[model samples]
Target: MRRVERALLSVSDKTGLIDFARGLSELGVELISTGGTAKALADAGLPVKNVSDVTGFPEMLEGRVKTLHPMIHGGLLADRSKPEHMSKIAEHGILPIDIVVVNLYPFAATVAKPGVTWEEAIENIDIGGPSMVRSAAKNHAAVAVVVSPSSYDGVLNELLRNDGKLEAETLKRLAGEAFAHTAAYDATIAAYFAKKLGEETESILPAKLTLSFEKAQDLRYGENPHQKAAFYREAQGGQGVASARKLHGKELSFNNIYDLNAAYNLVQEFAGEKDPTAAIIKHTNPCGIAVSTTLADAFTKARAGDPISAFGGILATSRPIDAATAELITGKNTFFEAIIAPGYDEDAFKILTEKKQWGANLILLEAEFGAEAAGENIDIKRVSGGILVQTEDKHAVGRADLTTVTRRGPSDAEIADLLFAWKVVKHVKSNAIVIAKDRQIVGVGAGQMNRVQSVRLAVEQAGDKAKGAALASDAFFPFADGPEAAGIAGVTSIIQPGGSKKDGETTEMADNYNIAMVFTGHRHFRH
Candidate 1:
């Protein structure tokens, strides 16, 4: 292989460039660098030739026109092996630049800064850097291009492999990656311009997006063994559980991600409230949820919903994890998979982490601002092929949203419980049935194909506990049979979206059972 005769080094991020350049210089490869890079290399007590010396053009327009000269382009773009191309280059006395190292200005970083001006941001865009990189990459068969600081080690190793020469295969790969890097940089610039210009219409051509995410960890398997899976950490400034900083713990699992997302999103619903709250999540549905004056009482009430199901499940709390509530939770012998809380008391941490199982899954996070900030609407799933998206169940129905369709109005206590059940029902799967007494869930039937079947499942789950309870459905009852089934299970009040054509029949059925019914004029069908 022919040795690299000359290299152009100009970079914004000089991570491993100093060492890589030193090795190159030691191998007798001549270096042609711009102002800052030349100074850096000269500062290291190495002989350096500045681009101005080679191009013979004084740096003009504040160094913007340094490397845009014909001499520089002629050397990098020339096909040395071709007689015609070589004749032109030889006539001009332009030296062949066998390698180019350049990284563009940090435009994205500058724009992301707070209170940045358009003029200031526009000024940070680099011109000569991208041009030089593309020129070198376009002639990869004769020259090597390096655009990323992370690839410095690879480039140095490749140069060392063939005694200071880069192989053709390595050159081709580096060129491809160089183009990818430039494309991503350009896309970010375009997106910023589009947003600032307030362009509402998407361009006819698809905007190619490249998201660089580092692998967080490997799971035991994907959704299925046949399917592949890997957890990736999104870039900083992104939101939700993926971005959550795990203060302490082992690696998170596939189930942990899903449950944490559900828990975090549901807790966002209670944001800005003074009351303490706790929610238990299973299979992406809240089995039990409660709010109280104290975090301890909230967990107690929430755990009462279905203590069996709460065992080895995910727990999410809105308030800081106080010692008392942590102690109460630790006292239970059940093995919970994960617990997500805003903050943890030192004592609580010591107590919780003592258990081996809890040590692997305890996640402590700072409480994010207001639950309402989670999102306006939550997306739900029916199957792999279809989805259902609607505004999240953040609705706290006022008297205006509710209209009594039955002869008797629900008692004040029943109304409160009806609203409680309504909130729980919204988080459950479609055709969901929730039974609540006082302010706690007694039973939850979810993901059934039929309303009556859902009612029966919830009633069976509650067993004798279904008596004197209010029932909430995710959607309107298609017929009166669901209400009749609830009445047989001793339900006393019903709250539904109330848009079914059989509304009269359902209301009459409620009246016959002495059960009060109210319509909220909205449905939360979480398929």
Candidate 2:
């Protein structure tokens, strides 16, 4: 344990400053401060010495050069255990500052306000504060640094318990927190500049990418029972699954988070439509999806598309869940791992929780829908050694982007089904095939190794429904076999990105089969 004799305190946030200084003064520790902090402590009837008195140099440059002095830094950075360091400080009449308490300017909050100027933001970037913190942290074996007011009570308790001394372990922990605080502060500044410069250059990737996450919870297990796992939320708030509120259910597992995100994203595709939309997701793939006039009708049609796969799946809806929709979801032989929606009616909420066995274990989440497109957000994927960052795939095909590739053009009804199927296929995994009639999905084949197998699986699942249904592929078919299989299944129309080398052959095959095909220059490949 190291006894604290002299302390320096400079802070932008002065919470608990007077009381803390009084506590230290009562314990025979000298209090030294600067600027407003010194004035505040003196006004509170505590004896405080200004920093200029110790350094023999007044603050200049509007208080910017106050603490950049040898007297302050040598005291904070000196090693007490080394005889040479002690002799050098003694020869210079420098007293060791056992405690350094500081908190930097609120750069993040200042820039977050509306219409903050560049000049104002640049002025708020702290220099001396981070320097003092690092000096004390680097010499943590002999100094204790406090960076947050939330830590004041703990420090005070330890000081009182140990009779004005702090253990090495406490100093080490506080040093770690101090470094993390500076890193996050610097990262916020870097990200702000990156955003401003990135817009003009049309490059979203930054030279240095610094991300920080806060632990939200420790889970029971990971994807399996043996693996340990935890959940983390980004330091910056955004609109995503992490912002959702769990109204009821068992603790969410890792797999539950994956499927919930997939279901919610799929349902959000129909956010612009007046009709209600619903999606059922299993294993990060949409098993069924539909848009209908009523919420109940949407849920029923979505479930009817693939009832077996819907079991133990996650359900997401774009509208508030009503009693009728809740009843359909909780029917006999129906079981869902979770359900997410904008809101839940009182009656519906009570029935689902009170009258069913699976409801007690089901995860219910409430999230906002249709706020805005996710095009501006960056998407990140982790690989073996590094991460791949790119913009989110929010590109949607409009009516003008579609080009007819066959002699037979899509009819008005077929065009509508093709558009709906295109939206659903974008959320599916790579090598995906989706069959839709009207505005509801009839069958979906996702995450297949080959395009032809996906088409066959979807066509086989659709059965007679494939006769006039529209098909959508996430990417261009490498060969004509996929379109040929769709033709044999009686698919009336198709939509795919036409970038393949065999595009001409695929179009010829479509003409021979009397099928209408449209090329949407953009492709969505989700893996």
RMSD values, in order shown:
4.7, 3.3
Where model 2 places Cα greater than 4 Å from the true spot, the runs are 6-71, 87-95, 108-124, 148-154, 373-375
Candidate 2 local lDDT, 362-388, one digit each (tens):
889999888762225678999999999
Against the hidden reference, what TM-scores do the models get? 0.78, 0.88
Cα lDDT of model 2 overall?
0.90
Using lDDT as the measure, which candidate wins?
Answer: 2
Q: Show how many residue pairs clash in every candidate, following the order shown.
A: 3, 0
